[model samples]
Target chain A: MKPETKTTSFDLAFYDRMAAVLNAWKHLGEIPLDKIPPHGMMEEITRLLYLESRLIDQRRLREWLDLFAADGAYWIPADVDYRDPRRTIAWEFNDRRRLEERVERLETGQAYSQIPPTRTVHLLSNIEGMLADDGLLHVLCNFHIPAQRGQDHQARSGWCGYIFRKENKHWKIVLKRVNLFDADQPQSNLSFTL
Target chain B: MTTYSDHLPSLDHQPYQHLFKPGFVHRRLYIDEDIFQQELLYLYGRTWLYIAHESEIANPNDFITRRVGGRPLIISRHATGSIHAFFNRCTHRGAIVCREPRGNTKGFICGYHAWTFNITGECTSVPLRQGYGKSFNLAQASLQPVARLESYRGFIFASYSKDVPSLTEHLGAAARLIDQWLDRGEKEPVVVQNGAMPFLVNANWKTIYDNAGDGYHPPFSHESMLKVFSNRYGDVDMNYYGSDFDKSPMYSKNLGNGHTFLDQRPEMHKLSAWKRQHVMPGYEVMENALIEKYGEAHALPMLDASTGSGMNLNIFPNLLIIGNQIQMPEPLAANKTLLTWFATSREGVPEEINAIRMRMQEDFPSFGEVDDSANFEACQEGMASIPEMAWIDIRRHQDTKVGALDPADQLWREPMSSDLHMRTYWQRWQELMNAGATRALVEAGVA
Candidate 1:
């Protein structure tokens, strides 16, 4: 596919729109207590998360990138309560184009940091789901990932909040935010997708 | 308190003088525990060390706690708009006073003993005054301030020694360079956006410092970034260091003291071409406005230069001003270092420009920094294996007759790949370490 040369202006109004979208995700209001998704829908959400985790573990970055909507964003904030990506530093904030570039870099064997590719296994549990007012499924889960490079091993635990939209019987990720417990701590090289 | 030199292994003139030659530095300088301790003392203790940017603590009673030169410090801005740096430890029992990394508070109260102090380091109250004797002095119980504090363009620096040279004198020509860069924006101050992005590497602190001013490693070490740039910008020369080094208008400058920077002004223009091709959302509008305001000839170059393609400045010991980030390395141990990168933006610049700065910052830490870290760890591991090969050569440009007197002389110009900057860095290190030994002997009256 040919890459799009057109670029969107990141002006004040663009930031305002992003802020509203992020705020809406933050204050989803606990599934309304009575509006929780049925057990089958919860199971389906869990199955989708498991499939996504497997794709990341398998290092199928191109396939994983295809699972996201065109306007989807993958955000890993330095702060758990982070709202604005423009004003502060974040661990990972990638639009679709950035994500594609990242995959391209990884595919090139010249990416020195990933020359000896890191192997990761993601363990996810406590899956919860609700149908939000915007007709999107809000799924939350806790994950513990054990990644290894040569003899070095590291365990990272985080809470993943995802917004998935149903399109033609398939679920597409609209947003994914992972809040790690030690997000602010000094980390080693995080070259691969979390 | 005992002097820093007294506790370390003797660094007297004997074997110390042989450790470093003109272009070769001993490997032990990086791995020796005794030398590391001495550096924490004579070098870091006596120098003007960068602590925090003033913008981090802009409001009254705003404070950020940081470890500067292996000591915990609380840098606070008082209600009067004055900044103060104090030891984070309490006077009562030496427990940490503030636990939060950053916050705004009128005063700090010790959780252990309830010893309260205001933002100015004045002890405001102490629990149970009657328990102490009648001569108990509240005045003596105040938080201990650092010996001296000074700021240049909102970059705060503190020194443990009051008698050291003034901060401006210490900075010298480097200060002028920094001022020129900061003043390039509109008259408004440069703001450091967000807190730091901290990373830990299994390498000595000096390893990180050495890499900051290094130009030779980029072409080889960051092959991936080069490939990406090559593919994106079809005109980009992939041979960054081969034949391009001869044509590239880039050189390394030792800007007095131990500070040095790489002048890559011409190469920056080449990289800025990518911006024009894949322009940001409102680049055309901004470009047209700039052209109308300043005329086409001037505005075009101005826009190109605004991408920060001039220099990569490294102030010795800690601070590194590269691209749009201020990176500082804190030494934790002989083989452990904490690296923090802070994104900086001009306060009065267009929001889109700042957004572009943020996008540029993503190129590092993820790819470029990870590549450097791999080399740092590999260098440390290599030194461990070959302890007998004590000297590492930094003699690339040593024979060049580039005396420090003339700034305009072509003799002073060396390719960006030269090791002149590292040689100058080690020369300063040897001088300061030798000065410590000389001072010790003079105090003992043996000289």
Candidate 2:
């Protein structure tokens, strides 16, 4: 029997809509306490982000994948001003399906670039609530990850904007956008997750 | 203060000539800083380096900053739409004039002395004009322009030496290929995508250049991508390394003037057609839209030609138009190189067509580039560790081969895996380096 696989239809309209949604969330700023989720819910959301970072740092990619919604996307804009990924190049613009494939490839020992995978310490700070409407919560934070591969060490710092939604009573990532400080500058190997 | 020539290797033509054979290159060429410096002066200094695409500075008073041959330059367009390239340094204090990567302004004002220059690189005003005597000429005070600047089909290139061949002569047969790729049956001109993706690789710039037309490494270096492609498509046979892959028709060509390219139209067209028919998301919608707008005859051929034209065309020195990406490499040091990828799109093409192009860019940095980077870093590390092993082989199909030749263009085409393309690059490098060294010797009264 052939192995079962999951696929998402390539819909330009769907992608366009998602881009609009992401643009809105990316521009969202700190919201008033009344407009955001309850204080306890806000803390839980921050905890989930910390857990996600820990999972990635531990190289538990599968567990990290579990934190994202089925339709979630991870994007890193090539432009600091955030040009549409469909019209321009991006450091990464992976949909849920593509993300799964990336995780699967990393799991395979044959992925040459990751043979001696880099070890990373992800430090998350400046967490702030942006918006909570339409059953989605937008949050923003700053991250500094120091990664070491062989004898080389690189410090990657970026601002992350995430849109979270509740799925089965657990906060799941619906969208994640990272804007690297040096996105326009030349970069060395970013083989591991940021 | 040591001059640049003082740092050049003492060895002359004889030693440099011995460094390259028909199918071998000396390891010193990759690791030696002296050779690297010489290359910066001889090879890069004389070549018609790609500086920017005209579309990037289409509007009046628009400018973009870039580094050419280790020197920062600003490419600017004036109100009349005339484009000019100038040294980014100010004349007074030599401070960088254009600090931003890209912007639009009527004129540039040097932060140090408030020296102002118009978009055409004419010195418009000086903060202390009265302080200078008649000896100070404002006409000569403008930012120093590059020796020569030219454009072909909106692609801009600049050379440091006025004595160098005209841009047309320099491009030669490579010009035809670029025109074919850029035109692509589109009425409107091709423009660069909004932004460029820049990334660094820990390897010699030549290593990256050599890989541009390399066909042997993909099957091995990008094995994971092929695997992922298979997993995602559920039809492994359509992958680049599929069992049904026909190797005979696909070939690499050594276009003169240090340009080399891989021609895989038959294979690429077949893959593109297959994807459009079976795999590509929204393929049917795109096809319908194109057919309705352009009619069946025009739309079908355009689609086929677009798919077939995706190839690796490296215009020697720094520019590489590989598939949909216009890539350029800047050599920072002997072991450090920065590569920038600019996505190109036809101005009037369907949005879906450009969407697919953007998707193709993801295939690289995510999978192919990292793999290539590993190999590049490994090659550099290995060559540095062992000075005893001096030669790297490029002799795969050197001795025995039946290859096609295009006499009019002076191009020789051979199987994809052949070393013809790499051999062509080294030959051009040797010729240019020897010429530069000879010129230097004559100028120094040593010849």
Candidate 3:
């Protein structure tokens, strides 16, 4: 006889929520017409995105940390389209505390993975932003980041989704999710943020 | 300090036998194409390769596609509640049948020709019947099964060799170690959850295995992480590898047949493993909730289980169990290896318990593993770029021995940093290669 379906605290609703964001990101044009942000807001959102990449590339990591809200999360799922952080093992799922530790680790100079240090250039496109049902600004874009560490070079291309909340008159990332095209495939050291 | 054995390719008729000796492994073992092929056949092909956790396919019709010894395989649970492993290759034209990584299905239909096979691997339907004469036997066209499939606890293993030892025999006393790991489930099932963090290293698979039980590298290889833990969390016992580390009660033991494990229980049991970990997002809330639900007495132990198993168990050739995670390294080529880590959860735990487990599980793979891959790749590069460095030294604490109290037959206990595990496993590897030499010679018509 088949075993009874086991139940745990893992909420399927989280998967449903993340899946909705992914579906919406994939078909941005199908988003409700009223949800689209104003053109100026879109331009501002794009500029914020560019600045985020610039801060990371310039190694202004402390400044980059300031771009997130106090409860911010940085997630890189092992699978691209579907993820339940509570159930699946993600490549990265960092709350603010973990992100702080990550930055501290990288700055320690002894993080051998980044000892020679990784040089990265991010090219972002297909930018879109909307005021979602959750009253948060949901921004989506595609990115191609070429990173080199010593002689090893990698081209990391992926789609990024950001759930932004206005905090203290500035846009702060509540959630920054990176979905790499080869998320399901094996990866070398991804010691840097995308 | 170059020994004559370092430069010698072989001591006798066996081509690769001389490459290994007590306390040393020749660098050629890592980079030689000829040696890699033989290793795939003699070592990986013949041994019990871990394919899946039975928890993954707990129900009938559940299947997941995986690679065993670099060959594609599908491990499925049939309707009779029995598990069977089949080569994913179709009987017609040799195309892979299943494309998805995992799913529960009534049956698998090859997208190539719509050839269908049941969950038990029977050839159920071929598009048009009577296309050929009676020469096309229906039973003959069924999926090819692996020679042997067996499981202990919830771990499933498959071997291609018909004459290999039983899985129980292969595991030896190491089976008891596995039991210790499984006991954490507390009568509830321990499941290998859906997602995994798979990282590839440009290094020989042996390099990865050598480092598994070597407690010497963490202080240097992961210096930053340890520093962060101390600075941020003030947990000096997080790693137990700091000052007086050698004095710490932790030890690495070599279980016979290349199986080995690092016992950190002595050190970890001093305080709860959960209290030692760097605090994360839901730590306080989850800890309190677990305490409230299971009460302080029962909840503390469960929290420790969630924090970590505190044991790093390495089953020879492929499987490495660290804490609650199962690590399987798939050797793709001489220098390309993919290591996949599956985080696990217990069947009866609260959602908060598993949630905390997931968050804590992200610690090593996300941070520490990157440094490991870096070293592995660097080791590969150095070995390949400079052939003159013929010996990959594993001589540290090599002279350490088993005490009178210890079981002398297969068990060897040493300080945490001893290279005894490497020495033990390489001995088994050499024995396999030597035995396989006759088969290799016969296959090549050299005999």
Candidate 4:
């Protein structure tokens, strides 16, 4: 039988509606480093970073979501050099809405990859922070997470870069990008937040 | 009674052939080292293994290093505009000539001895050549190329044996479906995007291949993903496979020469692909731009192109095209497999459309593949641990005579959730494996 290519006017409306809802993903590393944050400001930013890691480890996802600004994003690039989300694929690229969906899925207890749940201990180090001219604080830190699931224990080592913005007397993450050392290599199933 | 063992002492085809029954296969096929080695020689060595896409090395002198069938290869586009595949090993002292994974370069210089070879695998320069005898010829020192290389519709494939059937003959009826997929490009070239999402699964390559066309697993395996799709977006196009998915009209076909596909077009045609998707980052503005430029009629199909072609096409041994992604499962070992999903985009489409395509492509590998990998690992563990359960029963729909054959193409259509696809491939596998190493894959006029 011959394959047919049929077109309909109603099908056209779907594209229009979908395009209207789709947003362009931004590269988190686009901020320019102009100056260093004050010593106290760095300490405060470090405290917030520590709190974020702790929240994830404790499985307090809802609380962790609160640490992000309304327009925050969580990104894990497929490669360290891949800065353009438009052309490159990412392991995880979540906007606030997507992040909320991810949290909801995990909480449903049906996300089979995390059925028994992955127990993780994130160790953060080499923390440094700088302030952009626009009052955005960019922080860079090395991280090593020892995650265990069932009979398997995997040690994931990576460095994280974060952009923080202060809103109404609170520090919130605008973007968090994780760059694994073996970013381009074939990775095992990474279902949990890194 | 034949026994399946982890430490099988022989590689003889006679004893292993006894392990495959009519409706079941021995579990040792997934865990035994000797059988795995034999498979490498008999199946992968004889089949047309996918190597690289034409878009990957679109420009001359561009190259990528890949390990197909456990053999390290350098697929490069020569200055002469012809593509070439050669062993990645150096002619001198056996060191890897090119260390980098992929890049465009004039020539590759071996770090050990500074011996250089051009992109086309020609030995251009050799340091301290005078010290060697004049009998040592530069022409003879060129890298070794594979026995055969061929591509169809921008998909490149290579084989270490020249005795196999022609690529067109091997593709058989599957070519029509691949063309059906390519037609979405609207005559524009379908470009494989740069970044690849490759994940390691602790399972046999065939374990993943078996699941590729099995419509029975998705509702259970990807229940979470389906649930999220339903809760967030009402009635997504591809997410309709719920408890009653078996009753759906989708058909799984066994294309000849071990090729198979799970056709989701029946459901996909019910709705435009774009209308069924979860909302993306910047929808409104892009929608208006697309509608204004292409007009409503043209924009709809373009949106459909952004999602999958609604067909999960699996070419024998490797190569799977599902959604907007191209997957190739490279078997590292009997129990270790590395699956790489290459996201694809249309050449002439708008950046926003391709960008949205990229995001939608990540949905499966990140969410759905996680569960699939977990199951693969679990299946491997179970097979390795349970020696008593010697056979894996693949007998579903065995008695159902509800199949139609397209005599022109020799295509066989079966129920979506039937085991016919697996059985057909296994029957082909037994034919190849039992044929031993010396016989031609297709004799005289049989192909």
Q: Name the top TM-score candidate.
A: 3
Cα lDDT tens digits, model 4, B295-332, are 98988777767776788999988999887789999999
Write down the lDDT that model 1 would get. Answer: 0.75
| Model 3 C-alpha lDDT per residue in residues B6-41, reported as the tens digit of each score | 322342456676787666788999998888988988
| TM-score (C-alpha) between model 3 and the true structure | 0.92
Q: Can you tell me which runs of candidate 4 are displaced by over 4 Å?
A: A1-34, B1-15, B130-132, B283-285, B292-295, B406-410, B437-447
Docking class of 2: medium
Question: Over the full model, what C-alpha lDDT does candidate 2 score relative to the true structure?
Answer: 0.78
Model 3: docking quality category: acceptable
**lDDT by residue for model 4 over A69-110, one digit each (tens)?**
877777788876645677678888766766787888787777
DockQ (Cα-based) for each candidate: 0.44, 0.50, 0.40, 0.35
lDDT of each: 0.75, 0.78, 0.81, 0.79
Order the numbered candidates by DockQ, best leading: 2, 1, 3, 4
Error of 3 at B169 (Å): 0.7
| Residue A155 in candidate 3, Cα distance off native in Å | 1.4
Number of the top lDDT candidate: 3
Clashing pairs in 2: A187-B199, A187-B200
TM-score per candidate, in order?
0.89, 0.91, 0.92, 0.89
* Total clashing pairs in model 3: 1
